[model samples]
Target: MRARAGGIAALVLGAVIWSAAPVSAAPAEGVQRTTIGAAERATALRFWTDARLRSARDLDAPPAASTPPAASAAGGRQAAPGTGEEVRVAPLPAPGAAAAAPALAASDPTPWTGGGLISTTAGKVFFQNAGGGTFACSATVANADNKSLVLTAGHCVVDAGTGEVYRNWVFIPGYANGDRPHGTFTASSLFHLDQYVATAGNANYDLAFARLAPLDGRSLGDTVGAQGIAFNAATGREVHSFGYGGSAAEGNGERLNHCSGVEYPDAGREGSTMWGIDCVQTGGSSGGAFLADFDAGSGGGYLVGDISVSAGSSEYHPVLGNEALDLYRQAGAA
Candidate 1:
């Protein structure tokens, strides 16, 4: 259930519910998976032409004037103590020194001009909803054993309400204007937590991961360096979130923008325990990375959470706990 500030509608379109394709096997407990094979990947690549990619709508774009629904309470039991350990992975060496720019003000959505690994690792995600509506969001490559794992919001991968995953999913790293610097990578598999699936997008479990197929005999991490990821990390720290959010002022999703601020607990209409930052990023920003200890020069940091929802000037993200850690491990192994 990804939403934008200023009365935008949620990403899920309830008018036409659809079903997902058959999975390879039963998913592990508390997890859901959808596999994309070679044939499907080829079809997806053909479907997303340059024109169609440019015309795709932002998932968080404002719809007809109407009041959005209230967010449901966070459901599901808490993870047991010691269930998740703090983990970190160093990023691969990348060119470029840190940029000399002023710290972006809180709640300010500014275009990212610093050229670093982030320019290649964080990119736009395009897919069609279960109802065949073309839409776009944001995602980031994360360091993993397989070197092909991508992290995003759960709703960006599947509709929690219908349990139907999107179609023609593709990630274009270093996407800018209309250029794809690195080749597009298709999703080989998608993973989500059971709580988000069962509860219809509970914000507490809104995180998801994608296992991507290699491009031109190269893995995503090998092509574009990945950001280090962390689970069960301490909160209340400064965070830098990047995404290709659409807005008249931000090139309508053609360029990457970011927001930076200290994180706090969400206390707005969502009524969930997700973390919040003073950011004005809109709908397409969902599934963007919330990085901790980000270095402006190297454009690398530890992925702590992902964009989930936005209310007015504040944006929210799920707390990456044991369940999120488990999902990452599973995706990496896949």
Candidate 2:
């Protein structure tokens, strides 16, 4: 299936991007949820043995030539008709706010060699589509009930055209080439925005959350810990984006890559209000985390967004808004 809304795709500029249809005032507009059965969970676990892990294709590439073109490369829910282009302001979490300087303060994209909470919290997600092809995207653990929530991009969890949830879904936190430091956690169910699943290319609803089944009888949070998530967060602030995307410049996706920058209102397309950053991460990096006020030592921070779309060779966009926060609330309850 073709990618809808947000994800890693080669950016095509100067096109007349269409705006998203107006969404309802209801809190849960475009949200869809489903649970994975025991049998399916068992099958997914067995499917990702060492051999398959070595062979899974990186999902960072744009859709194949035969696939249909996506409606908009803009990633995020369409802003209301007359909202200004300025980045909206929101407050940061209170307790964790500290006086010490940030552990990672650089604005440049850097190779994450190792160490820190992010090492265990962020990892690569693997799934198989109806076409029988194995693919990958980035994902991270989030605090939730059952202590097994895995947050990622909607495009990674659901096929837009068929509305079929991707199968064989498993997350390998801190996954390095051939390394599964935290062991594999399979999903028991997945949740996404209804607008994303119903429409062909709605970036505003491009994110997703999954409730994972325990591996070796231990909950996911207990194993690697979970990151704090936020919605309707303050914009135009410094953010640290982490991913396992293929690096054309570096020539590998085996190691974690991160870029730090302040998010700004994207003005490239009309009818849509998306957040963008200046970073060069490419494919296979889709669904990676866009964290705010990240504490490198703690590996915990507010999950403001995830990798959604390419703005150019060096810039990326992630979705974070009211609808996205509502999706998280619904998923946590599920």
Candidate 3:
């Protein structure tokens, strides 16, 4: 699925849910994880795609008294997207109101993994003139080379409304109470589905990857360590997904929540994911990094996906599919 460059894709109105995807597997270097049974592959992949999308890391502001016509009228429907193939969208939930998720654990406010949100869409829509129109969200630090890179939802940085990109776009890994442990960085380049850049309508297709250029002359990773990224793997495998969102499980406003379990697939090509655990949450929690923290006994986390679409007790993430990895490799990140 390609972002429509300053345009949003056709939306099919319904309940809001969540999402991410990656393709191409580098040779499995770490301990090889077992794959899910082939019999369950079709079923698992089915629901993974058709999940609704929402924002992450912020409190669910009061529901809009009225939804905009453009947001309410999801009239676009096109052919299915490709996976492990060309860029394509998968079948997932419709975007919009679903239900207030159950309470979650209040997460740690201090960022242990050095991650934060990528966009401020939550700030843009819910609060006008807030943060100087500069919004705050969350994301996590990851390293492929010796550079500092972050993983987040596509819409966080890419403003579908204006072709112009984020102005104060910067990263503060290990942020706590506005405390930047790694310092600030302007995004050098952001990578997402061509679908997202083209259309703001596809939240399920929402995802953003980037290379950070330091603003304070402090290089990333040099300032703060980076999390390992897991590629070359299969679904239904056990992993951990952590983020700083509001909840009992995580905490409110500056907190972190980590959930772990096996991953399942979705229906459409976007290649959706259903977390094995339950973390009831609301808006302001999108773009959270999903890490598969299987330490070779080190007890650290390896990032695999980002929070894109979610709803109810369920959260939809984009598993690091094979196709997405190809994009990273093409960009020289992987």
Candidate 4:
């Protein structure tokens, strides 16, 4: 995918330029957190009207380098076994929410008709880049101790080079067109690995977590359920990835689309390790969940990784290792 001017590309470019300055080696272990205060949260919620969402541009994915980096090891410490469990809750109805439609069979980018937890757990993320342009990406509600954490790509939340978190970040769960069935939740804080900040959005640490503020006195998890998350899990498993990516045939990021395929290890520029799958999801799909062991009946699965980069018909996910585990732990506790 080619990087565009207004969305994630600008952030990545900023990070790249910043990394050129004299600096120490990227941190071996550390979590960086950006808190959004109550005032900012309120402003975010008010800023994203239905009109703005419909007009928001897709957050473009960064260009994938053809040559893999020279580093051989995964960037962080070895990952432990998978952890966290799926937390399913009853779906809440939103006024004017779109009715559930049948999902299409397995395809590279097909409509998600499995009307279950995923219909509520997976949603669209909207925010403003440093340039003040509104952009949209995908996100998932992860089962966290706080019941408010959502997972997305790191680039969606922060500009690695400048260490600046995007403004007016909010998530629309079960979003279809302009309908927000579960209401909108503003981001209370953003969390990611320090390595991502130091390395200018390294693919190895492209994942991020956003702690959300409750909407109408209801927490996001209680409102729409949350998916299980796993780290250091085995690769090569058949995975289902969901996103609201825009394409000429894909409803232009207005609807949920999915791809099912087996994942394999792939190397990214700067030695960043990632998981690659055969998928055609394009821009605006960044930060969507890549689930393993997805059950069609329940629409639930373990979140093994997230959409980070796209090259041709393949999409890449960050390998959730020790650094990602620590970031999740911190976000859960926040």
Q: How do the residues 159-233 of candidate 4 rate in per-residue lDDT, one tens digit apiece?
A: 766776777889998889789877889988888776666655566677899999998898888888888887777
Clashes of 2: 13
Instruction: Report lDDT (CA) for all predictions.
Output: 0.78, 0.66, 0.42, 0.74
Full candidate order by lDDT, most accurate first = 1, 4, 2, 3
Give the number of the best model, judged by lDDT: 1
TM-score per candidate, chains pooled = 0.88, 0.78, 0.57, 0.82
Please, what are the lDDT tens digits per residue for candidate 3 over residues 120-199? 11111111111223334556666555355666765565444332233334555544444443444555555555544344
Model 4 clash number = 3
Better of 1 and 3 by TM-score: 1
Q: Ten residues in a row with the worst lDDT in model 3?
A: 119-128
lDDT of 2 by residue, 217-320 (tens): 88887787777776566778888888886655433567777788788876664544557677756666778888886775555677877776664433444456
Question: Which pairs clash (backbone N, Cα, C closer than 3 Å) in model 1?
Answer: 60-283, 98-297
Q: In model 3, what lDDT does residue 305 have? A: 66
Best by TM-score: 1
Model 3 ranges with Cα > 4 A deviation: 1-132, 161-164, 215-218, 247-250, 266-277, 296-299, 330-334
RMSD of 3: 15.9
Model 1, 298-327: lDDT tens digits are 778889888877776788788888878778
Candidate 2, residue 329: Cα displacement in angstroms equals 1.9
